[model samples]
Target: MPPRCQNILLLGGSGLIGRYVAEDLRLRGFTVTAIARRYVASQRTSADDIEMPIMTMTADQLTHLMLDRKIQMVINCLGVLQDGPGMDTMAVHRDFTAKLLAAINAAAQPIQFVHISIPSAADSDHTAFSKTKRDAERLIAEAGIGSTILRPGFVIAPAAYGGSAVVRALAALPVADLPSDLASRQFQPVAVDDIAGTIAWLCEHGDHTHHVWDLMQPEPVTLGAVVDCYRTFYGTDRSTRIRLPGFLLDLGAKLGDATARLGWTPPVRSTAIAELRRGVTGDPAPWIAATGIVPQTLAQMVNRRSATIQDKWFARLFLLKPVIFVSLVLFWIASGFIALFISYDAAAGILSAHHFPTALVGPITVGTSLMDMATGALIALRRTSSIGLIWGILASLGYMFGAAVLTPDLWIEPLGALVKTGPAIILMLAALMTLDNR
Candidate 1:
């Protein structure tokens, strides 16, 4: 009906779904302009890949950008699972959607809006995440724009992120223990490629009906069965598994909430757990009939390709991230605490014995101890963890060099305190390397 849509604009281009969809669309001969808040080193900046914070932009600005780029289609992949530092559920899922709809209406040329949303459940309003999502869907339906809202079930992508990463980590664990109730809950998964394929189909056909379609496998599967599929892929299906108590899962959710406030987006947050309890389900018959896409089963998705070493490493390290951060936080804070209070005299004595000025000893000891404590605090927060790790590495290096020059004998001390600094520095470097959550 409408002229074949072209010149697309994709939001959240650096995300798990956004990245794959952007690449897929480009390969299919669409002029796609991908936008993200930030890009990794591997993704070079160019006209196609533009880094901009869409949340801060107004509708007028978005309209102007769309007009300037001559965008005929807008695919919004931007979404947040919970509220955290700079991550508001309402702002992202509802307010932004409203602005985007207004922008679409304002544009001189018509634009096809493709929004990626979660599958609806009876208890969709149980959490802020789902509530705002439903709010957005309603806004889109009422916007009077040619739009297609796709509600995808648990997405099984080659690249793991958010909930999928947690699933992989659980499968990779030596023992697979899950709460009995949660283990049996329904979890209908859709392949990421299917979502991409659907979008490509829309792009090719120029169909922008105001229709909300559920994209997932027809058959249902349990949460435990989904994990078992990953376990089978990882060749660990025979591992021992036990049913964990409900309280442990509750505790984990609480911990996840606590970490979220600190700027970390853990997959096990309270909102995430709430949504998980509700489980992922949807009727894909309408979508399949409309798009003529035969969705892949869980086995087909998992066994599409053999697991790689990198995939295994990521799965194993997914859970270890929190452990690494916690250890670093305690390590730095304890070191500072001992130096400042528990062993203040001993800390000052080290410098004094090396002929450090009497007047400078206390100030130096107090200042460095405070610096150590500050570094620990920074590392504890996700927003500043990278900066904190850099500072820690620098401080550790300074300590090593200063000790080598003034307290060389400390290197060979019975405690080997200086020798231990090397490993700590190495650990900090490792944390820095794995800092990015996207």
Candidate 2:
């Protein structure tokens, strides 16, 4: 093989690790292609973006894609922390990988396969995540292809996402609720850049067909220390750690497992907790000896990616955003219910006093009341939130206009009932501005 692989294919290029890997390889002037089920904005090559389900694709289709693309090196950067409704870790990590390896074996040209495997995968008895990863590693080894299995520890980048996002969130909490057993658990968190650079170097200079490198910094830092690093970076108050019993921690994980069913990937899932409890650390000799790259320490990594004012605010407001979202939903629903049931007769009488006929008063009251409830319902749903917010704003404006024209006295009423619409409108607008389309 040449010093620089001519054509490289990156699977799971949409993911954080894969994105970094692709960029690193591209910067080194290698011809790189990235393929994933979802569209990744970073993938620039038109030929690389194959937006199709990997698991569903047949062996022949995959083999054709690899050979047709003239991919000499294949990097598998796929893994899932938690399994949910649409995400099956076993299927992707194990089954899909098996299919890919089989395709590689059948291909006319030999492809150098790079597999991302978890540390301690061989020893891990719990969690399907670890087991499936180990199973994938076995398949890759048995496929008789040139393969490099990278067992990296906690991979961190300049900006955190996915599992790292969860770590930052936990670290930013005002008070840390940790399992008592976890304080001493240490991890050799590796910089993502190191992982990417090392992989690139391996593609160029590697001599062995099969190798397992532990990609991480040699220094072992405790789990609590990792959290503290983030907390310090964000300038959050030094967290007062409260340790919970093992049983309580287990219960929380169980709850997280249940919540995953609702399409929410809670950070504290049973598998995640199990992995954390086990800790993530690996030997650094193999990677350093092969790649000739010294890994950055946690402090070094943190210094390079110092948190800005916006980053700090974002970290603090992570949970606050959802809280505010839910609060707005409740506010609209409660306001609608109160207006519909309690203020009906009073509103009807007010309309009548303004010469809205008595018979029409009841009909108009029901109609407006139903509209209020409808707006609330719409706002409460993720799909129709923007529409609901607009409706709410319009409804509030309409109510205020009607009051000003018909019952002007209510604007200056002692309770300021009519005046409340102004604040309600402002709140609705605020909620609309923060609407998450993604």
Candidate 3:
């Protein structure tokens, strides 16, 4: 019953809203344990910091942690559009979410769960991912636990962790396209931090049994105007942010599903696009009438979570592919020089004694040589870059062992081989243990 306790379990803590929500709870003196691909436990002990005791774990790992930890609240902030790997993203969002609530229910003192959701949940069956959410919502409702679901739309976050990445990117384009009709279509883009603050409010007031909250900002603004505001905030007007036709939108959604399976970023799904274009959301006044949580205005939302406060390097890294290319090349050049400098005698001994190509070849020389070329090329490509790093790290162990074992030709130097090979043990282990690339 004490969902506001110091200890809470949050799913999707890495997301824009999740991060803020976790932070907000910590600010309110709650001990937060957020689960994502990684851990983000707060190190700050300041009164403003609100340290959330977070823990990162995989699905199987989570089950174990839940069984052992003194978890009082489980917040399902995990929502997905493409429904990355596993049985269903929505089930993880909604049904498994309910299951978590049920586990809390079975506790001597039940756990309180707060779910973040979106509109059209009942009709979510039209798509595989969201439909799972729709079903999960129903299951959670049936579970008869103390739970709440908050559905919001056009959720504009200051960072790159959510489905609105393309929308935010489009807003920054130098000359973005704006449809005349879309320029007038109303939207209530909710701010990330506002949602976080509101969630903390709901957790404290769970006694209200106010199950649903349609998060909306005050006053509806046209979509173009929204883009324009974001563009102004970002100081860009280059985005050709034109609206796609209905047919093309549907096609894109299919492509998103297909590409999602292949571990590629798919175009925005036409189904969601079409739904937004069609203006499917209704008034939020009734929900406000129920929970008394007035939505913040665009000005307020922006003031609290302005893009200016976001780290610019995050976006710059996305734009600078050439920098990465140059670094890889430089690394290759440096490796060659370092080998020549450290193993000049070994190089001369082999070259003088053995045949031209044969002397250049030894397990250490060949294996490490292969690593340099492979890693260089791999880093050059977008798809294989991460995998390439893993290979480069693992391949070095073979080379380093040979450097200490067989003839030490002038490929990767003994010290260099050890440097490259050591820490990669974990990297290689992580690669081999991948679940879904997407």
Q: Encode model 1's per-residue lDDT on 1-438: one tens digit a residue.
A: 433777899999999999989988887778899999998867644468988988999999999999999999999999998887889989999999999999999996779999999896645568888899998999999988889999999999888888899999999887757788888989899999999999988887746569889999999999989998999999888888776788888898899989888978788878888888888999999999988999999999999889999999999998898889999999999999999999999999989999999999999999999999999999998878999999999999999999888889998999888999999998898888888876
Top candidate (TM-score) = 1
lDDT of 3: 0.58
Instruction: Kindly list the per-residue Cα lDDT of model 3 for residues 251-316, writing each as its tens digit.
Output: 656756554554444436554565456442445676577567677766565445445534333333
lDDT of each: 0.89, 0.78, 0.58
- TM-scores for every candidate against the unseen true structure: 0.95, 0.81, 0.63
Q: How close is candidate 3 to the true structure, as a TM-score?
A: 0.63
Range of the 10 consecutive residues with the lowest summed lDDT in candidate 2:
40-49
Query: Candidate 1, which ten residues in sequence have the lowest lDDT sum?
Result: 39-48
| Whole-structure CA lDDT of model 2 | 0.78
Best by lDDT: 1
Query: Mind giving the per-residue lDDT tens digits that candidate 2 earns over 327-412?
Result: 66677777667767887677777788788777788888778777877877787666577888898899889989988887899899
lDDT-wise, the better of 2 and 3 is: 2
> What TM-score does candidate 2 get on C-alpha atoms?
0.81
Question: In angstroms, how far off is 378's CA in candidate 3?
Answer: 5.5
